[model samples]
Target: MNGKQDLSKVSVLLVEDEAFMRRLIQRMLEDLGVGEIVLAQDGGEAVQYILNNSYAFTLILLDLEMPRVNGFEVLKYLRSAPDVGNHDLPVVILTGHAEKERVVQAVQYGIHGYLVKPVSKADLISKINRAMTKPPIDASHLK
Candidate 1:
């Protein structure tokens, strides 16, 4: 994916537990020309937001660990919930570790890509473009 592609139409739902990391990524996305960015402090907040407006965002950047609802649970809800209007919504995991096991597990839930912590602007652009342009993963089996 080209790092220069315009992203003025993209909207992202960013769900992270840490305040600092959330702010950092939000700034990165803003600098990248993303049209809208919604912040969710944790996975629980993300779930509630999704329940009410699942189709509003173009993509989701989700942290794997949290206090109450984890990224895995949010992924499950997004992929399997009967009420969600857009089951194929693109998701990218945001994790501190890139362990093979963890990445593999996230793949089962149909994550588009992942970013290691302290994400670079270039890597962020690439992943977002790749995720948005790729065909949606079929998660009907999650139902």
Candidate 2:
């Protein structure tokens, strides 16, 4: 995409439990020229970091399966938490499997998009572009 240069201003919050996967994705993002990337070990850590630094991110790449808190809980918090400023913040799920029920649940909770495991840099860029172009999801009704 022509926006590779534009990615220099983007800040991404990547939430993944697996260290190897996390590093791999981070490196890809960096290679794509994302300006700032923050790492969270799991949903629990991601939530805490978001609570304090919600404004620091332009996008969230979330992993559903986690040790604690989990992606769904974080999605609930983002969509319903009174303290959250940007309820419509762009979110992309980084999932290993695209289960029907899980996808439905995620959409109901308001994810912008999702990427299957073993993400390619091209796929990552495409998802990010699509998510950014779309308007924010109003999942307040789901609360």
Candidate 3:
């Protein structure tokens, strides 16, 4: 799939703690022709943004670790919050090489996909396409 064309109308929420990585990913998203990219430095800020904003996001690219709320907490909130209306929203986890346990937990939480740190542009685009086209995850089993 051509990411630039496919993503042209899609808005994304990027939750990353590191400044450099965030900027890098933002550039990659821009290059892919993503419509609007909303950035959150950490999970706390991301949750706040989700609560306050009425705009719908096409996808969420989230880092596993952060200072305040952490990605897992954010994922749980998204899945469980009655008013959020984003339980089915596609979420892709971003993790380092050592975070195997976290990745497993994220899968149990119904993550759409995941990418290791220092993600390549090709991989990012590929994952985004896959997540966008993949069927929604059923989190009811978790209850």
Candidate 4:
């Protein structure tokens, strides 16, 4: 992709537990010109997928609350796992909780962006564009 408008080269791992929400986000991503999307129902599944295919995704759209492992845990794992080779991967938190504490915590975890529930396409695209422009997080900074 040459510019923010062209996400044709972008590939994402969408980790969401809700089936309906997952489909909705997937459609939005497709509309944004994303080339590939890998789905994970929960954080544990996301972890497994990331481990198996570390370099496959250009970004991750992670849900904060899930049945197994939650987004926070997944973030920690990604930061700590040397073998995964994804410590710098962009992760945008997608959550219903917009509480100050939760948002602060996510920021501390080095999330690229945070999107509240009922996300609009415009907001999503803007956030994605902003995140994509930033330099990848250095794993050493987390420690």
Per-residue alpha-carbon lDDT of model 4 for 18-114, expressed as tens digits? Answer: 9999999999998888888999999999998899854488889999999869999999988788878768888899999988778777777788888
* Models ranked on lDDT: 1, 3, 2, 4
Evaluate all candidate structures by whole-model CA lDDT and list the values in order.
0.87, 0.86, 0.86, 0.84
lDDT of 4: 0.84
Which tens-of-lDDT digit does each residue in 7-117 have in candidate 2? 988889999999999999999999989999999989888877778854578899999988768899999998899988778889999899888678778888789888999
What TM-score should be assigned to candidate 1? 0.90
The residue ranges of model 3 lying beyond 4 angstroms of the native Cα positions read 136-143
In lDDT terms, which candidate is top? 1
- Model 3 pairs whose backbones collide: none
Better of 1 and 2 by lDDT: 1
Q: Residues 1-143, candidate 1, lDDT per residue (tens digit)?
A: 56567888898999999999999999999988899999999888998888875448899999998888999999999999998877889999999998877777788888888899988888889889888988643444333
TM-score of each: 0.90, 0.90, 0.90, 0.88
